[model samples]
Target: MMLPTDPAQNLAKLIRCPSVTPAEGGALAVLEDMLKPLGFAVARPTFSEAGTPDIENLYARRAGDGPHLMFAGHTDVVPVGDEAAWKHPPFAAEIANGEMYGRGAVDMKGGIACFVAALARHVEETGGPSGSVSLLITGDEEGPAINGTAKLLQWASARGEAWDACLLGEPTNPERLGDMVKVGRRGSLSATLTVLGRQGHAAYPHLADNPVRGLMTLVDALLDPPFDAGTERFQPTNLEVTSIDVGNPATNVIAARASAAFNVRFNDTWTVESLQAEIHNRLDTASRRRKYRKDRKEPVEFELAWRDNPSHVFLTHDDKLIGTLARSVEAVTGMHPALSTSGGTSDARYIKDYCPVVEFGLVGQTMHMVDERVQLADLETLTQIYRRFIGDWFGSR
Candidate 1:
C-alpha cells in the first residue's frame, strides 16, 4: 500500500484503532510504523502504578543540532458512549459527507495525525528541520495521568534531553481551525468539606446543631465575595459547589452530618497554598458564626479533604514558539488566532515545568460526542499550518 500523505488518511487510520483511555488498543502501534519510515527513533515505554492501569506511551525524535522542539499529545481517547448512537461505527473510520467519523477523531487523534503529516511534508520539501523534533505522546492522558507525560518528561530530562519549547496539540479551536490558541491554563483545586453535628428529632427546638445550616453558611461565604476581579490574562477565580448531601433518609431526622464538595478554577493571582489558606480562613470564620438554632453557640465541627493533585496555573512566553505558530496560522487561514489563557487544564500543565509550552489544534466542537469527527478540510488546513510553523521555526534558528 502507498504511504498516505494526507492528514485525513492518517486520521482515518488512527481512528480505526480502539485506543480508549488506559488501553494501548493498537493506536501507538500504528504511529510507530508511520514515524519509522520518516527516520524517527521511536520508543514505546509502558508505565505502571499500583492503582492505575499500565499505560503505553511513545516518544519519537529525529535528531538534529539546534533548538529542540517537542510536540505533545495523547493517542488514548475517552470511551465512546453508546456506540450504537453513532452514525457510523465509533472505530470504523467511516468517511461520510466529507467528515471522518470515529472515536478520537478530534480529541485528539486528529491533531496527532496532522502533526505527523506535516512532519512528513516538511521532510519531503526541506529535508527535515534544522533542530531536533520530538513527540511526547501518551496513552494515560485520559485516565488518572499517573504514568503519562509527567513521568515521561522526567524520564527524558534525566537522560539529558532538554526542549527549547513544547506544543500540545489538544483540540484548542472552539469553532474553526484558526480561531484560538491557548497560551495558559487556569489552576484547578477540588475539595470536600464535611460538617459534623449531633443527630436529633426535627421537632426539638434546642436538641441538635444542624450541620446543614452550617454548610450553607460556609458555601455562601466561599461563593459570595468573588475570589478576585478578572485579571489581565485570566478570568476571575470562581468556586462551585458540586455536591451537598446529608445522608439521613428521613426528612424529620436532623442529620448528624452534612457534606459539600466544591472546585475552584483560579488564576495566577493566587498559589495553591494561598488559595487554600483563603478557603480555610473562610471556613474558620463561618464556623464560628451564630447557628440557626440561636441558643447553641458551639462552633461547627468540620473537616476538609483535598482531592487529586492541584494543577498550577501556567503561561508560556516563548517568542519563537508563539510567534511561529501564530504567523503560520495566519498564513494558512488568513486569520490571526487569538492568544488565550482561557481553558480547562491539559497535559501542558505537566510539560510546562519542563519547558515553555503552548496548545493549538483542530476545532473541537465534536470532541467526546457520540459521533466524534473531524472535517477533512480542517485536517489539511491544520497540517498546512503545522508545516508552515515547522519551516518558519526551524528556518529562524
Candidate 2:
C-alpha cells in the first residue's frame, strides 16, 4: 500500500472537493482514504440540532501505548466569491508562479494536508510515533458551528476519548511560515440591541420619537470607555458594530424601531457574564441621558438580545507543548516564531476545554481572498515542522 507522503498531492486531492460549509463535498471521504492506509480506525459521525444543519465529523485514531495527541481542523472552505475572478479555477488546484491556487489552499485544508503528509512520512520512516494520534475534523466550522467542534468534542469524550495535548491546524502565521504560533485567543461575544419608538412623519419631529437617536446613544456607549487597557499577555478588548438596521425604506418617515448588532473580541479582563453586565449598565445609563431624547421623560425603551454562545478567552500554559512546537518551527524556518494570542476565534476555543491546545499552520496572507493560494515551498516546510513537532512531543512525553 502506498502512503500519502507528499503534501502537494494530498492537498490537490482535498482542494478538488468543493466542501463548502454544510456540505461534505467528498473531502472527508478523501481524508478517510488517506488515513485508512496508515492503520487508523476511522469513524464518521453525523451530529444535528433542531435549528442547525446536520454536520458530518471525522475521528480517526491510531492507538498506541503513550499519551494521545490530536490534530484538529475543518475540511470546509468558504464559498468562492467570484469564480471568474480567480486566476485559476478555485477547485482545480492549479500551480502557477510556484503557488497552488484553490479555495482552501491556506485557510484550513492546506493545513490538514501538510499534517497528513507529515504523519505519513513519519509512519513510513519510523513506524509512527510511540504515542497515540488522532484527527478530529469537522465539516461545520464555516457554518452555524452548532454541530461542529464543541459537540464533536463532547461526543468523543463520551466514548472514552481524551488527549494530553492538541495542535490545531489553523492558519496562524501572519506574513510567512513560522512567523507565529497562536498560544491563546481572546473571547468573542455578539449581541443585538433594539430601541423602540413611535413612527411619524420626519417633518413632524415633535409628534414622534426617533429610535435611531436612541440607538446611536447606546452604540456610542458601547464604543467609548475602551473596554480595557492592553493586558500583559493579550491586547485590549475591542468591539465592532457590524450592522445597524431600521427596516424602514421611506425617506420622510421615522422608523418604529432601530437595531444594531455588535461583536466584541475581549481579553481576559472580563468573563461573559461580567461583560454582559457591563454592557447592560452602559445601555441603562445611556438610555436615561437626555442628549439623544430631550423630549422624552422615560428612559429609552430598548431590548438586548445575545446571539449564540459566547466564546470564552483562553491561554495555554503547557510549556512542553508550546516549547516543542516553537522549536520545531524555528528549526525548519530558521526564524523563531512568536507565541501570539491575536486573530479571530477558532475551534481551538472549544478544544481548550479538553486539553491544552496550540495553533500553527501555513502563512495566512491569502486566506479567504479571490485568488487564495499557498506557496509550494510552504507545504514542504510546514510538513517538516509538523513532523518534527510530532516526534519531539511524543518523545518528551
Candidate 3:
C-alpha cells in the first residue's frame, strides 16, 4: 500500500500502532516503509540485555559525502492509564475540535511525522542536501532504557556510522510551537540509608537505642545546609527524602532498624563521585558525634548503598547546530526560541556522549494524558521548522 505523505495522516498511522514501551507495535515497520521511498538505507537492530526485554531500533541513512546530521526520537508511548477515560479512543487517532487525538500525538509521533514531511519536502525541493541525514528511532525510551539509545549508538559505531550532530524530537516546547529548545539537563542520583538499633519496651529507655532519633538527626544534617546557591544555567542541588520506614505497628515496642531513601537533582557544582563522598562524610561525622550508646560506648550502627549510576551533567555547545535550529524556529513561527536546560532527563542524555545534541518538538500540554492530541496546525508548523532547519544546516556547510 502506498503511504500518505501528509503529516497528519502519517501521524495518525503511527498513533494507531499502540507502540507502548518495548513493543514494536508495527511502528518501526511503518517508518521503514516511509523511509524506503525517500532513498534511506534502513537497518532495524533488536538490542537486548540479561534483564531487559529486547528493543527494536532503527538507524537509517541516505548515503552521501558531506556533514552527517541525525534526528532522534522514540516510537514508543506510555500506556493509557484508563482507556475509558478518553473522549476518543487512545489509538483511534480521531479528529475533533480542530485537533488530532491519540497517544504519542504530541510527545512525539507528531515530531516524527513532521520531520519525515520536512525531509520529503527538502528532498523534493533541493534534490537532497550536500550532506546526509539519518533517523534514530527507538522503542524503549519510556522503559528501563537498557536496550535503547545507549546500545544502538554502540551498534552503529561498530558499523562505522558516526554523526556530526543530532536533533532530538522530544516535546521541549512548553506553551507554544517555537518557545523553547532543551540545551542541557540536571544530574540525578538516589541512595538508601539504613540505621540499626536495639529493640525493647518503650518505657525502658536505658535498655534500648532508638534508631528513629539517629536517622532523623542524620536527615536534618543533610537538609539543613543547602548544597549550593543556584548555578548560572541550573537551579541549586536539591535533596528529597522519598521514604522513611520502620515497619513497626506496636505502640510500646521500639523497632530494630530505620531505613530512609533520598534522591538528589544536582547541578555543575559536583560530580557523581564528589557528591557521593560528601554524603559519606556527613553521615560518618553525624555518627561520630553520637558515640556513647548508653553503656556500649559506640556510635550508631548504619549501612548505606548507592542504588544506580549517577546521571552525568552535560551541556550542548555546538554553535552551528543550536543556531540553525533556533533560526528555523524563528523563521517558521516568527518567535525567538529560548535555549533551556531546566527539565527532567530524556534519551538525549545518552546521545550527548556521541555528538552535540539539542531537543525541539511540539507543545507538550497533552502528552501522556487522557485523549492526548495535537492541533493539526502545530504539526504543519513544526514540519516547516524542521524543513527549514534541514536546508539551513546542510546548505550553510
Candidate 4:
C-alpha cells in the first residue's frame, strides 16, 4: 500500500473527523489506521472518572532496539463557536488561496498530520529510524484535561513503556511556521476569592458593610506589587483578575457577598505552595489594614478556593532534544527559532514529569479562533523539519 506523503492530505482527513473535545469523533481511528500500515502497534484506551467524560486516548509505537523518542499531542480540537461566523464549514477542510481552513488546522491536528507524513517519508527512504518512535495522543487536551495526557502517561509507564525524550506538536510558533519553538511553559494557578459582608438597603448607608469595597482592596493587594522580576528563562509572573462579581442587580440593595476570580501564570521562582502563601499574606495584610471604613474594620471575611489542577512551571535543557530541534528549525527556515516560554499552559506541563519535552509546530496566530487555518506551504515545511530532526536525532543517538 502506498503511504500518504503529503501532510496536507493527512491533515484533511483529520480535519474532517470533527473530533471536538472529549469526543472520539473518528479522529484517533483514522490515525490508528494510518499508522498500522507503518508497522505501528496502536492502542485506543478509554479511561473514566466519576465526574468527567470517558476519554479515549491513542498510544501508537513502532518498535526498535535503540533510544526511544515520543511525539505527544491531542486529536481533539476546540469547539467551533458560532458556526455561522466561519468563512467555510469548520470541519470541511476546504483549501482556498493556499491555505486550509478548519478548526484544528493549526492548534494542532496539523502538527500530528505533518509528523505522520514525516515519519512515513523517513521509513520509505531510509527504512525507519535507528530508534523507536511513539505517539502519545489524547482526546482530552481541549477539555477538563483530567483523563488525558496525565493518565495516558501513567498508563503507558505502567506497561513498561519508557521514552528518552518527548516533543509536543503544539502550535508554538507565533507568526510564521518556524518563528518560535517553546522550550518551556509557565505554571498556571487559579483562585476564587469570595468576601462576605452584611447586605442591606443601599439607602441605609450605615446599616451594612459592602463586600465589593473589601474585594477591591484585596485585588489591589494581589496586583499592586509585581509577583517577582521574573527569571532568566521566564517572563515576570502576572496575575490577572479575570472576573469580579457581586451578582447583585438591585440598585438599592448592597450585596451580601462579592467574589472575584483571578489566575496567575507564574515562573520558576515561585512554587504552588510559596505562591499560595504569598497570596494569603497579601490578602491578609490588605484585609487587616483599616483602609476600609473604620467602623467596619474586620479582617476581610473571605473564602478562598483553588480551582482545577495547577500546571507546574518547567524548562527543558537536554542538549539532545533542544539542540536537535533548534538545528532542524534553523536548517529548514533559515532562521534560528527563538526558544521561548511565553504561552498558556499545555499538556507538556504533565509530560515534563516523565520525560524531557519541547514544542514545535505550525503558526499559532489562528489557533482557537474563528476561521482557523494553516498555510499549505507550512504543512510541507513542518513535515520536512520533523523528518530531518528524526533522522539527525536518532542518527546521533
Candidate 5:
C-alpha cells in the first residue's frame, strides 16, 4: 500500500473535487479514502437544522494511549465568481509556473492536504506518533455555519471524545509561509437596525417623517467614540456598516422604512451581552436627538434584530502547543513566526471551548481571489512544518 506522502498530489486530488459550500462534491469521499489507508477509523455524520441545508462532516481517529491531538478544517470552497476569468479551470487543479491553481487551494483545502501528507509521512517513517490523532472536518464552513463546527463539537463531546490541544489548518500567514500563527481571534456580532416612518410626497415634508434621517443619526452614534483604545494583547473593537436599504424607487417620495446591517469584530473588552446593552444604549440616546428631525418632537421608532449567534473572543494560553508549532515553523522556514490574533473569526472559535487551539497554514496572499493558487514549494515547506510539529508535540507529552 502506498502512503499519501506527497503534499502536491494530495492537494490536487482535493482541489479536483468541486466541494463548494453545502455540497460534498466528492471531497469528503476522497479524504476518507486517503485516511483509510493510514489505519484511521472514519465516520461520516450528516447534521441538519430547520432552514440550513443538511451538511456532512467527518471524524476520523487513529487511536493511541497518549494525549489526543485534533486537526480541524473544512473541505468546502467558496463559489468561483466568473469561472471564465480564472487563468486555469477552478476544479481542474492545473499546475503552471510551480503553483497549483484551483478553488480552496489556499483558503483552505491546501491546508488540509499538507496536514494529511505530514501525517502520512510520519506514519511511514516513524510508525506514527505515540498519541492519538483525529481530523474533525466539516462541509458547512463555507455555508450557513449552523450545522458546522459548533454542532460537530457538541456531537463529538457527547460521544466522550476529548483533546489535549488542536491545530486548526486555516491559512494564517499574510505574506509568507512562516509569517504568522494565530493564537487568538476577536469576537463577531451582527445585527440589523430598522427605523419606521410614514411615507408621503417629498414636497410635503411636514406630513411625513423621513426614516433615512433617523437612520443616519443611529449609524453615526454607532461609529463615533471608538469602541475602545487598543488593548494590550488585542486590537481595539471595530464595527462596519455593511448595508443600508430603503427599497424606495420613486424620486419624489419619502420611504416608510430604512434599515441598516452592521457587524462588529470585538476584542475581550466586552461580552456579547454587554455589547448588546451598549448598542441599545447608544441607539436609545441617539433616537431622542433632534439634530436629524428638528421639527419632530418624538424619539425615532426603530427595531433592532440580532443576526445568528455571536462568536465570542478567545486567546490560547497553552505554551507547549504555541511554542512547539512556532519552533517548527522557524526551523523549516528560517524566520520566526509572529503569534497574532488579528484576522477574522474562524471555526477555531468553536474549537477553543473544547481545548486550546492554534492556527497555521500556507501564505494566504491569493486566497479567495480570482486566481487562487499556492506555490508547490510552500506546500512542501508547510508539510515539513506540520510533520515536525506532530513529532515534537507528541514527544514532549
Candidate 6:
C-alpha cells in the first residue's frame, strides 16, 4: 500500500468529514485509517456521563522505549454558522487561490494533518523514532469537555502510557505561522449573581424595590479595581459582565429580581478558591454600601453561584520542550515565535496536569470564520516544522 506522504491530502480527507462538536462524523475514522498504515495501534473509546452526551475519542501510539512524545488535538470543528456565507461548501475541502477551504482547515485539522504527515515521514525514513509517539484526540473539545481528554488520559495512564512532553495543535498563531506559540493559558471562571427584590408598579416607587439598581452596584464593585497588574507571562486579569437580565418587559413594573452573569480570565495571582471568595467579598461590600438610598428596606439581597469547572492558570517551564519547538519554528519560518499565555482556555489545560504541553499551529486568520481555510503552503511549512521538531526531540534526548 502507498503511504500518505502528502499532508494536504490528509487534511482534505479530514475536512470532508463534518465532525461538529460531540459528533463522531467519521473524523476519527479517517484519522485512524491514516494512523493504522503508519504502524500506530489506534483505538476509539467512548466515554459517558449522566448529564453529558457520550464522547468518542482516539488514542494512537507507536510504541518505543525512549522519551515518549504526544501530539494532542481535537477532530471536531465548531459549527459553520452560515453555509451561504462561505465561498465554497463548508465541508467540500475546496482549494482555491492557493488555499484549502473547510471548517477545521486552520483551527485544528490542518495542524493534525501536518503532524500525521511528519510522523509518517519520520517512520518511513528512520523506521521509527528512538522514543514513542502517541496522539490523544477527542471529539468533545468544542463541547462541554466532560468526557474527553480528561477521561482519555486516565484510561491511557491506567494502561501505563504516560508522555514525556506534549504538543497541542490549537491554531496558536495569531497572524502568521511561527508568530506565536502558547506556553500557558489564563484561568477562566464565571458566576451568576441574582438580586432579589419586591416587584411592584414603577409609579409606586415606595412599594417596589428595583433589583436592577442593586445588580448594577454589584457589577460596578467587581470592575472598579483591577484584579492585579499583568504578570510576566500572563496579561492582567479581566472580568466582563457578559449579561444583565430582569426579564421584565413592562415599562410600569419594577422587576422582582435582576441577574447578571460575569466571567473572569485571571492570572496566576489567584487560585479558583481565592478568586471566588474575592468576588463574593466584593458583592457583599457593594450590596451593603448605602450608596443606593437609605429608604430601601435592606441591602441588596443577592445569591452567587459558580458555574462549570474552573480552568486554572498555568505555565510550562520545561526548557528543553520549549526550546525545541521554538528553534524548530524559527528554522522553518525565519521568525521567532513569541512564547505567550494570552488566549482562551483549551484542552491544553487538561493536558498540563499529565505533562508539559505547548501549542503551535497554522495561521488562525480563518479559523471558525464563514469560509474557514488554510494556505496550502502553510500546510507544507507546518509539516516541515513538525518533522524537524520530532527529529530534534528524539535525536537529542
Using lDDT as the yardstick, the better of models 2 and 3 is 2
Tens-digit per-residue lDDT, 136-184, candidate 2: 9999998888898999999999999999999999999998898999999
Q: Which segments of model 3 are wrong by more than 4 Å?
A: 1-4, 289-297
Q: Which pairs clash in model 5?
A: none
* Each prediction's RMSD to truth: 1.4, 1.2, 2.3, 1.2, 1.1, 1.2
Cα lDDT tens digits for candidate 3, 1-397: 3433578988988999989998999999998888988889999999988988999999999878899999999999999999999999999899998999999998889999999988888777777778889999889888988888888988998899899999999999899999999998888889999989899899996788878877886787678689899788888989999999998999899889999999988888989899899888888887766533435457768898898757877888999999999999999899999989877889888899889999999999999999899999999999889989999999841
TM-score for all predictions? 0.97, 0.98, 0.94, 0.98, 0.98, 0.98
Looking at model 6, residue 94 earns an lDDT score of 97
Worst 10 residues of 4 by lDDT: 289-298
128-185: candidate 5 lDDT, tens digit per residue: 9888999999998888888888888899899999999999999999998899999999
lDDT of 6 by residue, 120-153 (tens): 8888888869889999999999888999999999
Candidate 6: residue 65 lDDT (0-100): 80
TM-score of 3: 0.94
Which candidate, 2 or 4, would have the higher lDDT against the true structure? Answer: 2
Instruction: Show the lowest summed lDDT stretch of 10 residues, model 5.
Output: 388-397
| Overall lDDT per candidate, in order of appearance | 0.90, 0.94, 0.88, 0.92, 0.94, 0.92
Q: Write the per-residue lDDT of candidate 4 for residues 1-397, one digit (tens) a residue.
A: 9886789999999999989988989999999988998889999999999999999999999999899999999999999999999999999999999999999999799999999999999989988997799999999999999889999999999999999999899999888877888999999999999999999989996999899888888999999889999999999999999999999989999999999999999999999989999999999889986666566756878889998788889999898899999999899889899999998999999999999999999998999999999999999999999999999999931
Give a tens-digit lDDT track for model 1, residues 1-397: 3444589888988888999988889999999998888888999988888978988899999999898999999999999999878899999999999999999999999999999999988887777898999999999988899899999998888888899898899999988899999999999999999999888999983687788888887888899798899789999999999999898899889999999999999999999999999999999998877755366577878999998789999888988899999999999899999999997889999999989998999999999999998889999999999988988888841
lDDT of 3 at 396: 40
TM-score of 2: 0.98
